[model samples]
Target: MKFTVAICTYNGQDRIPEVLDGLQQQTNPEGIEWEVVVVDNNSSDRTAEVVSQYSKNWRGDSQLRYVFEATQGAGYARQRAIQEAKSDLIGFLDDDNLPKENWLVEAYRFGQEHPQAGVYGGIIHPKLDVPLPPYFNKIKSLLAINNPGSQPFRYQRNDKPRKVPAGAGCVVRQQAWKERVPKQLQLQGRDEKNKKTLLIGNEETEAFFYIQNSDWEIWHNPAMEIWHHLPSKRLEKEYLLKLSRGFGLANHKLRMVRLYPWQRPLMILLTPLYLLSDGYKLASYYLRYRHEFDSDLTKACELQARIGRFMSPFVRA
Candidate 1:
């Protein structure tokens, strides 16, 4: 089976080399084909040039190609990668993510076994560039670091939708994307030029829901591993607050079906109660973890998120 591994970047020139090197070292099964496609998300730096250098010097079994996506958001880059991909299975990796040696092979095996699966993703351990705060352990999930388990489980149709596979280090099936990620479901990720604003961005998570609704399954594979590099700036209070609000906005955007546009106003009206409930929950979390974390970062995030969710209909829809 052929595989298209996509790496989306914005001003990631220096880090792209390590990610490319990791892909180069992948140990795919003999005769199985794989390639890495680097999508430059309108980078201001030499990201394109660096990737081109690696592409020209590639000596591994996998092929390497570079695509310049003039669009400014990571969402646009991801969509372009899907369009440029030629394989039945498309694996996504961020510019700083370093995948394990057997990532491709394991993904291929899972895809072969579960033709019904829509997406597959695994652990995202932190590769910190700075010291972790005492509260870091209590709030790591906010950082997008996930480690579900060490087994593979295909999701089933349950009352509540299954948990979304984390966006990083995941492989998406072409059939699933074609069925779910059409124009109706497309959502913009971050806008690189406007660095100050935090917009909605649970794009991959929303896609999994669409695919599941289309009678497709989502799987979590523990064997597929990658490192998510986190810098000191990301751990700051201001950035964390923005991320919290972004999460709130993204959650609302991901679930609000424009097909039922009439319901948006109702949701918007009920936002206050939801935020109040969230406030109560925030208090509970603080009471539970106050000894560990001194600040009410999580509480502030929830309030901001509720505000964003209330505004999601106007902002994204």
Candidate 2:
């Protein structure tokens, strides 16, 4: 079976090389027909030039190709990648994500073994450039650093506080995505041009919701793994708070996607109940940790997220 590795980037000229290097060092991909496609999402930097230069001297068995996507948004870029891909199985990697040497083989093997799986993701360990902040574990998920133990398991579809795989280092069945996901998603991820205004996320989760609603299942494969490089800026309180709020804002839309059209009104009516619970938690958290709130980035992020969720019903889809 053929496979495609798609790296979606925006102004990631400096970070894309290391990811390419990781792909180049794959251990055992002899029989597998795989190629790497870099989708440049309206980058203002020298990303195109760097990928072109690398493609000229790429030594891996897989051919390196670059595709430019004029429309800005992670969702758009990924959609373009799916269309341009030559293989039915596509693995997505962010420009900053570095995979292990056996990532390609393992990811492909898992997909081959499980035809029922529409989407699957593996462990993501953080490669931090800065020191860990107080209560880092509480907000580490915002950075897409996930390690859900060593065993592989299918994600429960009916679980509250739903668990979905992060876009980073995740593999998808092209047929599943094409059949279920819409051409234009409500949550389009962060747009570079409107960086200050747009913070809404969960474009991938929205897609997963549609896929899981069908006969497909989502799984977590322990054998495949990647390291997400986190710079100091991502660890800053401001960025973390913004990320938390973005995720919270997307929660309602995701909830609506999972429910039937008839159940949406009930979900909307239940929004106040969710807000009340979140409000109590936020207030209690502030009261208990008033003194440490300033320094405790995790608590601050949680409060911001709660506030975002409270305002989610009003936010336009």
Candidate 3:
């Protein structure tokens, strides 16, 4: 089956060139059909202009196209990609992600070979615009830096199913998106405004569990790798807290989604208990890092996320 490299960008004219360059560098085997589809999610900048220029310069068998998703969220852009993509497998690369040259080729090969896995993801290392902070290694996992080792395996950690695929460098089958996600699940993801200010968002994470429940297996293909750009701004204590809160909110939403309609009422009754459990976990982490400069960030983030999750029921879709 052919593969579609789907990059979601919002006001990314400045940051998208590297990602486009990475795609232009792809080494495709003859007869392998693939394409690059960039979903411009309501960009205020010249993101479309940059992509249009690159489309003319694309050299590989993969054709480049620019799609405009007027919606502001990444989830909406992703859903648009699902519709716009011509291929069965859609490999997602965030706007700032710099994929390895073989990313497209390996993704196509892996999806072609592994029919059982509906979704597959690879490693994501940090592409830092600034020097790494001394405390970075302590929270790399939270930062979305994933290695999962050089050995390829099914999506699992310590013999349990992995929670979510890496945000970027994730290759998902159109079949899975069609079967598991009938439509974009409420479009609860980051907007440019949120990223700049609140930082509260979880665009794709919640869908992982929904897809898994549909019996679509998830996998890790080590050969498919990308570098996710982490600017100095994202490395700040405040941003981490915001991201952490987003994670919590997303996790709660995932749990809420798993409930049957009949169970939601009872789940509502049990919400406090659930939040309390999360609170304890947050407290434990806080105590562990309390002396550090960013000690309270995680705890505060969890609190904010839990609050958002609890309020999710009231939010109109």
Candidate 4:
């Protein structure tokens, strides 16, 4: 069966080259036709220029194509790619990630081996120049490690047949996703006001949830890998704060999605407590790690509270 690699990018000029290069190097099966489709999510940078350059020069057997969507969201780009995919199997990779040469090969192999599964995900690693702190590394040990260009992970035990992840490195059947995900939920992407902000989080998680409920098996292959680049900006405290707030907002949205309508009322009561405790732990971590003092602690704490307030009324409304 033919497979199409769908990539979504937003202002990804500097990173797209390596990803394209990695794709060009991939070795596919003799009869399997593969192609790459890049959906540009309204990039203001030289992203289009870079991809255009690569498309012109790529020598791979798989075709390369670039499409532009002015809607300004990753979800929007992803949805467009899904619609345009020419293959029955669709693989997703971020512009910032460098996937392995045999990534799609392994994905197809697993799909053939277990025709029951609709979704499959591989490993991901952070391409960091500096070593993470001991505490962070310890936590990461339990999770996937990010190294530049190479990430290794052991396959999750297949004992429990549960919902699997479609985030990062994943290949999914087009027919399965179209049947399981609502058009409304697939509209994930960047916020219109601030292009840098993601409109949703846990989008893949939500999709996997639906797939699981549909009685589709989600598979995990630890052998396949992708190296995710981490810029210095992502390492800063402010960005981490933004990430936390976004995560909190996503949690709020999941509740609104009626995933747990019965538990929504409980969240309303627990939100304030949870935000306060989270703020305290983050504040302590900041005070210990960051030597310079800043009163942004107050602002950060207030932001978390504001998110809770915003979510509370939205659920009711």
lDDT scores in order = 0.76, 0.86, 0.75, 0.66
Regions of candidate 2 where Cα sits further than 4 Å from its true position: 196-200, 275-277
Separate clash counts for every candidate: 0, 0, 0, 6
Q: Which candidate leads the pack in lDDT?
A: 2
| TM-score (all chains, Cα) for each model | 0.86, 0.94, 0.87, 0.75
**Which is superior by TM-score, 2 or 4?**
2
- Candidate 1, residues 104-163, lDDT tens digits: the string is 888888888888888988888999988777767656777778998888887654536447
Roughly what TM-score does model 2 have, to 2 decimal places?
0.94
Question: Which residue ranges in model 4 land beyond 4 Å of their true spot?
Answer: 29-31, 138-163, 186-189, 196-200, 255-317
For model 1, where is the 10-residue window of minimal lDDT?
A: 252-261
Report residue 87 deviation for candidate 3 (angstroms): 0.5
RMSD of 2: 1.9
Positional deviation of residue 188's Cα in model 1 after best superposition, in angstroms: 0.9
lDDT of 1 at 267: 76
